[model samples]
Target: MSKEQQIHGLRPIIEAIENGEEISKIYFLKEGNGVLFNELKHKAKQANIATSYVPEEKLYKLTKENHQGAVAKLSPVKFADLEIILETTDMTANPIFLLLDGITDVGNYGAIIRTAECTGVTAIVVSEKGSAPINATTVKTSAGAVFNIPICKVNHLKDAIYLMQAYDIALVGANEKASESVFESELNKPIGIIMGSEDRGINPSTLKILDQQIKLPLKGTIGSLNVSVACGAILFEAIRQRMF
Candidate 1:
């Protein structure tokens, strides 16, 4: 995270959240409470920004300047508007999009983005909450591919799914228990592939909206593939299908 990404003080934090800033998380003093604190918490929750109650020591360690009992981390990457992206996309080209559902690991997020860019994915759609912050670590792990791809951060993943469907884009989710394998599915079409977080997989509700679900074939003893690796395999298959 860059110094510019950290916003401190209650008023500033609340204003940032209210202004639709991409705040990754907020750390507020655990013992702090009052009208100001309540207002700050309310704004953060309304914007789906993560919040944590920490000790005063923790706040002091974050900065030498007064934080006024609160601090917030902003995302390093600017988010693209889904509507604008959808409007400008050439539908005839069979564009590919990656939808991340609750993916919280920055390293995995970065790797997946790098692979997506390599596979010619149109854009990456992530939820405003429960997704990894686009920080320096993610950018470094992606080998700068973060800058090469468009990232659409929306208030809700389901809404993005609906918008894509309206555009005639097929939604394919990668589920461990899906009946078909990635190779068995046809990928030569405009599509969005949803990859879930490592812990919970795709949200059950989100899964219902998918046009179809496919999983990687695990012949070995391993039960699951790393999220990033799974994403790479699925994307490259599409690339192979589209290129050949």
Candidate 2:
């Protein structure tokens, strides 16, 4: 088992799955009854992962800490190698990649992941830190889309961006200073869109190498959209342009 394999509150288990951790099976208090518990049962069935309802004593035996009346033995998920993810996807032709720069909000993270699955994106690349760890809530919010998509985590965001460009992907950053708008940008070729954080935009270091920059048309006083919403807008545009 990996060192990340651990026991924590019930909510933490959900986070593990959201970050693409493999779960061998989930265990619940055999006698507990409630709506939230029921929903958990149903979701496990939908995802096709194993589940077990055991006595509270078993959960206690496994861990003395607060198990929150449940414990899940998680198995790690198989992640794609960085090089394999670069070459195996649609790199030769017009490929589409999404780089999440410092996206830490769990809800936003889940929404973006859900969008990635819907748009037929090549892969979702995120950094090991400053990102929401795949967990249970993310699974719930994503409506199981995280299970279908390929999520790649790297040590550094800049290195991942460097490698993607080597694969010939048109790396673009969504910053306010960009001269072009999303509509004017050419996304018909292999592309990678880097989205900034909600509170703070993309890291300055990575911004130095941006192949191009584009901003969304803002007609309102707010002048900004959530990171997840921005990701959907950009990615679906790629899908739409490629279709027609």
State which candidate has the highest lDDT.
Answer: 1
TM-score of 1: 0.93
Q: Which ten residues in a row have the lowest lDDT in candidate 1?
A: 1-10
**How do the predictions measure up, each by TM-score?**
0.93, 0.71
What lDDT is reached at residue 125 by model 1? 97
lDDT value for candidate 2? Answer: 0.76
RMSD of each: 1.6, 10.5
lDDT of 2 by residue, 1-244 (tens): 2225554456676666566665546778899767656665665655555567899888777677887766666633354567787867766668788889988777888898899889887788877557765665677678888888888877688999888888788789988777798888888899988998998788888889989888888889987888888888888887888988
Kindly list the per-residue Cα lDDT of model 1 for residues 122-208, writing each as its tens digit. 899998778888888898899999888899888899999999999999999999999998999998999999999999999999999
